[model samples]
Target: MKTVISLLFIFMVIVGCNSTKNVVTTDTVSKISDTVKIANEELEYEVIIIDPGFSSWIAGRALPRGYYSEAYLENKNQFYVAEWNNRVAQPMQYDSNLYLFRIDYDLTIRYGYEVNYLIYNYFIYFQNRYNQRLGGFVPKQ
Candidate 1:
């Protein structure tokens, strides 16, 4: 009877320990994933901002600024031309804003570092990969 009681006590302690470890492990994983997501998002935002085509037009021109406070979808194309209307200039000139635009957006990655690589690399990889797998920029036919 004494041996039986001791064995059951040991088993109960082991079971409790396992449950605690699992809970801690799950929390840690959730935290890491959240961090990676934030980092990836920031990387995307940087790519969109530094892009020469859009950066040029964004500067010196009085226009409505798009959402710059957060990560936005990046256009896969390295070079892009978007239509912009400037009525202030005599006989409004329609200019193109260059940068790949994103049609869909994910709000998860607002800040942090991703496991794959530096956040910026994600943007660079995206641009390079898209260009490699698909055809490059060309004016509409």
Candidate 2:
């Protein structure tokens, strides 16, 4: 019994030490279906997460009816995934496979970065593929 208890205690200590506590606000929780608020400890800017299910969908779903090749979509998806992972201080803390399921058309775009254009285009592609009329903001390419 003592040996078992010691092993359990050590396991808990290891798990506890590896975990990170995130204090999410009510606003973030309410808008979770539409936006993702990832706290980047290293970066100065906040990433306005629009789609939470993008990574998983990309991993699981087929490519939408479009002129873009499967390789193109796959490459783009990989780019976004890698970029997002690099953005976060602890990549393992968040579920990289998750993507937003709903759309909030009311949220205005702010803190616009050039990379957002790429992300937005991918969002538009996702919307088109899933037939989800989300954020109607389409990209030219």
Candidate 3:
């Protein structure tokens, strides 16, 4: 009788833990879809969050130049600005997002450095990834 009672208690605890996970998952989805607050209240900026499932192909071509926000690299909402003539455009990512664009250019260089860097890096990353899918070999020319 004691063994059966112990099993029942363990099952109940497991079920309770599962239910809490479900609730938190639902809440996160709702917040991502509904929350528009910027990650930093001190920084006055606009946020354009893209859901992770969407196609980010065109968005990759539209990265801004300059130094990017550290928060963005750590899965937070961030918009970065460079003080003109920076070497490469910095890009950041959020876990639930497909692509986010911060498109304000108040710079001196006519050439878009940051945007170019982002496109190049992304291409290289994907190219490397697909190359591995093809059994990691240089095609015999």
Models 1 onward score TM values of 0.18, 0.24, 0.19
Worst 10 residues of 1 by lDDT: 9-18
Candidate 3 lDDT by residue in tens digits, 1-141:
432232221100001111111111111111233121122112222222232211243244323434444323212111122211121233332211111222343222121232233323333332333332112232221
Where does candidate 2 clash, by residue pair? 51-100, 52-98, 52-99, 52-100, 53-98, 53-99, 53-100, 54-99
Q: After TM-score superposition, what is the CA distance of residue 3 in candidate 3 from its true location, in Å?
A: 58
Model 2 misses residue 32 by how many Å? 14
Compared with the true structure, model 2 gives a TM-score of: 0.24
Candidate with better lDDT, 1 vs 3:
3
Better of 1 and 2 by lDDT: 2
Best by the lDDT measure: 2
* TM-score-sorted candidate list, best first: 2, 3, 1
Ordered by lDDT, highest first, the candidates read 2, 3, 1
Between prediction 1 and prediction 3, the one with superior TM-score is 3
Judged by TM-score, which candidate is best?
A: 2
Q: Which ranges of candidate 3 are over 4 A from the true structure?
A: 1-30, 34-37, 52-102, 105-141
* 1-141: candidate 2 lDDT, tens digit per residue: 432232221100001112233321222111344443433232222334444454344334534345465445444544544433343334365322323122221112221222233344545545554443333243422
Error of 2 at 45 (Å): 31
